[model samples]
Target: MEKMLSVWKTAPKAGLEVKEAPVPKIKDNEVLIKVKATSICGTDLHIYEYDPWAQKRIAKNIPYIFGHEVAGEVVEVGKGTGGISIGDHVSAETHIPCGYCYQCRTGNEHICQNVKILGVDTNGTFAQYVALPYKNAWINDKKIPHWIATAQEPLGNAVHTVFSGEVAGKTITIFGMGPIGACAVALCKAAGADKVIAIDRDEFRLGFAKEFGADVIINGATPGTDTRKEIMDATNGLGADVFLEFAGAPAAFNDGLATLRAGGRASILGVFPKPFEVDVTDGMVFKGITLTGINGRKMYDTWYKARSFLSTGKVKLEKLVTHRFKLFEIEKGMQILQKKEGMKIVLEP
Candidate 1:
């Protein structure tokens, strides 16, 4: 491939541009994949909106291509890349880690200090072709739908968060109804959770939570609805045994922790635009709750679990994918996503 179609953030301002870019060249340890399907992520939305977080993190990298989630076919493989070949169907692990880092050496490469993200830190998969480190190219099951394959990376986030603590028979509350939060609802149900409570400001996303088996769905934005009290009441006043926070809202953070039972676990995977204050002593220390800040999939562990759930039909993704468009129609996808009408929007090149 010589020239490629891609969505680009060409300026430090809001919005993106779809234009032609040179097909990425693969290094000795990399592979080139023809993108068959790709999807937008919340991170992509931030970059497109050029929020404060985007301004501080990626504005300097203007004229860059950004999008991480994808499913594609291997078109070229470098000499040093083994266990992967041309024609292999694949999805990518978006976290590119430096193997020699302290965290990487300790089997926690998911949090490597020098990690580089696919879309945020480098050129990404929202193009006709992309070059990726062979180690990060996850060979997909040929039977998995291309659109569904694009979600495996994000699904891994849900799986990691759900399983980070004991989930069986526990009451779990997820404070966001985004794609990942929806997946967490399904995961908790499939893993034998006794009750699932989902909270979100958007009614559209809350609908997915209901379909995925949340025992109670609360619209925190609904006129004067007390979300914290609703969650506590749903959990029989003991509060949730586990709280998974993905809303990235300050109120959600404080309320989620305050409602969690003492000695319970909380897994937070959201990226807040800015740091906010919280009552740490009463919220976490005095309560003796466990909190884990998830960054990316846990190296390859989450990958294996995510693949098993997706390929075997254990967790359905087709329903969660509410919109689709050509890569050229990225503007439409972005609009729908911003309106909260689309759950996970897939783009084809």
Candidate 2:
């Protein structure tokens, strides 16, 4: 039996366990990968806390493995597979869209009606051995380390958000300095944004945000003397031309809207737990702002952009990796992630 780290349902709920599971077998047109590195995402924290999203969406009756950010080495390739060889380093797209879906046929496969996410719907990368369909896998240059390869998934979100609208030489303000938010800060700067403002409650994170090239950092929880005003003041009193919300906090959502200049664009990439009630009359409709919600990025489009960003030295991924763990220490890894104010943590299986 091969040992796997899995998110399982135990009494008191939200409980995840690491168990010794049978190694998976691959089908034709598939490859078996021995996981080398995987990262804990913000979604994992919600599952750990048994948030409403977890209780409602995740089936509690069965053992579920949760992880999507993964990179590994191919150990076995099934029959009929081509363009891949054993020992190749790879990462995969998590949104496995059914090609026959209406959205897929319309060139909107990112929102395909029938989508199977790797970790959430089935056993994911938390295991030592994971079998993936050939279509999901992408080969990386040999120099790219497994840790950086696993990070491509989340980094793709940053790439998608920054490029959603024109970012070159634009004034960008990012709210909620989480990992993805931090990624946005760096990406915006690298993309030639004139200014990038990083907002968060933690001073430590804001400090780290500077490492991502945040030109300005603000603490959002400082007893409310109008933090938006400070952001505007920092932006020469015109407000940010683009406001990106990476923190799903309802307050951050509202603040981001309030901080945008008239006719500016905004991107919402963070996952909020509840319905956000914002006054569309102000800043949105009246100001003629363009607002877009971001989901699982454009599969191949974002992938190509992210790989190019990594390969061309636009994004330095090594700075984002703050913690590492062997496969057996997954529980400890989860505990560190629960604290919430560190850089990326990679689990090695």
Choose the strongest candidate by lDDT: 1
Residue-level lDDT tens digits of model 1 in 47-95: 9999888998997677889999999999999988999999999999999
TM-score of each: 0.97, 0.94
lDDT of each residue in 15-133, candidate 2, tens digit only = 57777777888999889888888887877676767778877766642466677788999999999889889989999788888899789998888888988888777678887888888
Candidate 1: where are CA atoms >4 Å away?
none
Against the reference, the lDDT scores of all candidates come to 0.91, 0.82
Candidate 1: 10-residue stretch with minimal lDDT: 306-315
Clashes by residue pair, model 1: none
Candidate 1 C-alpha RMSD relative to the actual structure: 1.2
lDDT for model 1: 0.91
